[model samples]
Target: MSNPDTSSGTLPSHEIIVIPPSGHQDRLLLLDQCIHVRIDVFVHEQQFSLDVEVDEHDPIATHFLLRLVPSLTPIGTIRAYRAEGEKYYKLSRLAVLKPYRKYHFGRDLVLALHRWVNEDAIRSGLQVARVVCHSQLPVKGFYAKYGYQPEGDEFDEDGAPHQKMVAYPS
Candidate 1:
């Protein structure tokens, strides 16, 4: 179902803001909101351990925060990082607030993150071949809608079925 305006019959405007990489002075601006989204979705709702939900990668991964316009409250987040010795990025910790899921925030976050990564790679003269994610099994089709393909056999991750999916930047 689509997210509909409650009173005026219009949805609220929103935007995605990319968090600077670790060590940047502005990096902490959205880090709390990003962690809030992850805790809500992955830890509390999805039964993932707090330690697992907030892991080592969080400090280094590039994050994107979705903010509702006007109020500017963050409601969704996604992150990505390049693997050592690899020519692609690993996308992870995508989470949308429960109340904002109907607005396609998750999809928007993914697309924006992909674009940001591609642009950065180009600027740095890095040849990034693809964006990869370990997608929860039930949502594999969601990633497929964005041109991601399953790369290998499905496996269990944090008690949920997961599949390695890959998508090339256009």
Candidate 2:
């Protein structure tokens, strides 16, 4: 596998994009792509259970698809949704294919999600909104780059240790 750390940070702006639900593709198609990437990343690569991979939240969550430019092949995905009675938005299911990971598409994916959350909050007439993700132990630092901080003690989720990270992205 190529080293994501040593790869170049720059990519042609037109070559990669993170898209929300729209006429560019059917909603179901977009979601299906999201699930495929998650299965590849979380289930196959990380040994997460398939049963928990696609949960009830998927129906209500706003999903984003990351596609390669021109060909528009789906390579990564992410989602954000508000849980019942929760005051903040929950971001989850972020995944990028192994080869594509070296391109830093994951950063763009998370940024798009944060932009959506902030815009959604503004539309709802809210002054503040927090976005939280259950970050796996190894990538907790990845979330921290976007201002997310560990909020509590680490615990097990999906048979792996994780930390509940919170980010107040404006």
Best-performing candidate as measured by TM-score: 1
lDDT per residue for candidate 1 within 44-66, as digits (tens), equals 88889887788788877888999
Score residue 121 of candidate 2 by CA lDDT. 88
Candidate 2: count of backbone clashes, pairs at least 3 residues apart or interchain: 0
Give candidate 1 misplaced runs (Cα > 4 Å).
Answer: 1-9
Q: Where does candidate 2 have its weakest 10-residue lDDT segment?
A: 12-21
Worst 10 residues of 1 by lDDT: 1-10
* TM-score of every model versus the real structure: 0.89, 0.86
Q: How much lDDT does candidate 2 score?
A: 0.82
User: Which whole-number lDDT from 0 to 100 does residue 158 have in model 1?
Assistant: 82
Stretches > 4 Å off in candidate 2:
1-25
Alpha carbon lDDT at 170, candidate 2: 78
Full-model lDDT for every candidate:
0.83, 0.82
